[model samples]
Target chain A: MRYGGDNRGRLLIIVLLVTSLFLITLDLRGVQVIDGLRTGTQTALTPVQKAGSWLVSPFRNFLSDVTHLGRTRNQMEKLTAENEKLRLTLQNRKTADAQLKQLKGVLNLAGTAGYEVVNAKVISQGSTTSFTQTITIDAGTSSGVRANMTVLSGYGLVGVVKYAYRDSALVQLASDPAFKIGARIAGTQQIGILSGQGTRKGVLQLLDNTTQVRKGDVLLARGSQNGRPFVPGVPIGEVTSVDNSPGAVTQTADVKFYTNFSTLGVVAVVVSGSSADPRDSLVPPKPRPTPLPTVTIYATPGAVEPTPTPTATK
Target chain B: MSLRRFFYSFPIFFTVFLLQEAVVTQMRLPAGGINLLLVVALIWAALSTPEIGALTGFGAGLMMDVSQTSPGPMGHWTLVLIIACYAIAFLGYGDDNIRGNPINIIFLVTIGVVAAQTVFLLLGMMLGQQVGSVSNIAFLLAGSAFWTAIISPLILKVISFFHANIFGMRSQL
Candidate 1:
């Protein structure tokens, strides 16, 4: 009877090993059946994952708070003072913008670029077993999200949707080593391939080396011909440093992606783009000194030019 | 164990997988974070016969392969985990010193996770997947092993209590 256990196990292992080998072979060959299996699996587990995320969020936050206890306390103190000031301001009957900063910023960014977007919440982060950096979002095919579609935050490009199910989608984060995108220097035609190095920064290898890529130059997605993956003029990152190597046909530059994938809360999926490319229209405005506040109690319209509404709305 | 006895493990493994993906993965940890599912699966396998151990590994591997976050071809984790967990089962089988001791179980899990990941990396590279730099892989494995060891005691007690309830014993399969 004891020996029976070992024999049964050995036989089962052989069967399973063969099955796994078969599956791997077909998957590596890009078989449609395997893809279907993957999709089916994703579809089945997405709901469970979403529900688990909901249940796990409080615990996650507590752990996060514990890790950043000192910072949390400091923020608490700062927010308490800010709360007092906001309370006094609220007494004046002025309406406060209560929307999520990321959501509002994304909406404003889409408005600037004229891309119709479906806003979505980040449901969960990467899988524990997977080597890739990925995230699951609450939007999917029902919201017109398609595979290979561009996903972005208010700050800039987040990633591309690798798989889109009915109600949820898998996003390959921009920080994954497998992530790659075509980028162009802002205000110039110098295009290149930008690939992630598994960090906040990416490596941009300019296709044309003759055009001296300078430091601090901004990069934008060149956009696929049909825009299946990306839309033109979405800011990608800024060049931090350039590789200066001899006998090289291409020069690489280090760029820090504009969007911080770690802290992503609210993002938007571009269902469809505008008639125009909205070239350079979505570049995050440079930080400027806040205009001095004038205490003109009765001053209303045109008293002082408040930061000219970032762009003239359509 | 009979098929009925094994049925109890399916939901346990499933819940562990969900917790690993949903709660554990979301945490910003130093070396990628803990593989709660892997640790639990190994410990379960260690406490059981080789047959049950292989089954647990296969089931857990399928869950991992189906994950949306996995980038490699399907069945990679399955292939690696089955072998690793099967080996662990054999190592711990018929051995009281390894099964009854928390420290021994800790080492078993730590070694199991590291060995599985190492095999995964070699296989991934063979299949042309970009696994990352060698140093990065080393750091990730070390961190995973370190954290799993640190938490194995708590996991050991929890699993012990749960298994005692289900199997009617703590240290015997």
Candidate 2:
């Protein structure tokens, strides 16, 4: 009996050791067994995920409502201030009229680029403690949102679409570690690669060591194709700091993103188009002329004569 | 009977896995964020049989490894989670008390965080990646661990509710 028990224990130990060793080897080889398991897991959990997301939709809506309320308040305050300024400026009628004409001419000269604005909504977010800062938007192939398309809010650039599905797409923010954008300093035109470093921070790598990039300088997309895909001069971020390492060939700077990602609300997906064109969807619509009311004179001869007689008596 | 139980638990395990992938990852706190799935796994292990707990940990960890951006070996998380589950189980809390015990939860979280960081450090060293400053790693680990510890109770409560209401287990809580 004792011998039999000892044999069983040894067998159990052997089995455990063998299984662990097998798992380790499988792991080292980068085997797809885990991937298969993950797919299987995802498939099985899709319904639950959908349900959970639906249940949480109200919370997201509430958060969005709060965000929009704050934004509306800010916009109201801004518009009020602008209204006062415009009222003051209205005192100089001739100068204002000339400025308006010049602006209108410039707008008329600009032509439309190819793309149009199609609206999209955010659907889901990344999962993990490591901060998968990507957002999945509802716009997909059918919506004309393609991979590498730029997504922007009124504030500034939100992110670039990394992967697009038939009904949804994932956007990797400029703050994600994997994102890289070619940018130039707005003032000095120093070209550099803006790479995300996993945190909410990004580093700008300049080509020339003596590049004249300063704090508060704006960064814009470089080599924009007629400003269609990415509208040229759309503010990306402001340079926060510059770093020059001794003996290093190039200089680098940290950028403070214009978009307040922590409180992201509504964003507009700018389709490809020429920035010089007056057909920008973001531009306010032209004011329509008020139509004059037409009156038909019914010449009732008797009524007209009586009215003239009454007026003469008065 | 063991296989049947595993098969039954598969759906719950899969849901936790997907939640970790889809929702929990987006919650960013300073240093690092809380890994709610890890906390759930620890709690589940404590409330169940040790063998099953270890297996679940291994399975979930393997899924995490695949889902993560890390290009390293797949079973790295699996090994770490399994070891953590086993260690937590051996700490010898009674099944009934383990569910609501704050001390137990904290202990398990500490072990899990330590195990995870240690494994990652070792893997990084083996893979010839820059380990960065030791102080930085320590700071990150400590901060993340505290964050995870603080949130573990809430996660535990939610998982326990699910286990009881959905999975039909009678919980001590």
Best by TM-score: 1
Candidate 1 lDDT, A191-296, residue by residue in tens? 9999987677888998887888889888998898777788788889999999989889899999999998877777888878777887777766777776664543
Error of 1 at A62 (Å): 3.6
How far in Å is the alpha carbon of B166 misplaced in model 1?
A: 5.3
- lDDT by residue for model 2 over A147-223, one digit each (tens)? 67777654456777765655666677767655678787765777898876555567899988865778777787663
Each predicted complex: what DockQ? Answer: 0.50, 0.21
Which runs in model 2 stand beyond 4 Å of their true positions? A1-54, A57-118, A223-234, A268-314, B17-33, B47-50, B62-80, B90-102, B114-147, B155-173
Instruction: Find the candidate with the highest DockQ and give its number.
Output: 1
lDDT per residue as tens, model 2, B33-114: 5566677777766655455556666666666665533334555566667767655654533444544675676677666766
Best candidate per lDDT, number? 1
iRMSD, all candidates:
2.8, 6.3
TM-score of each: 0.84, 0.62
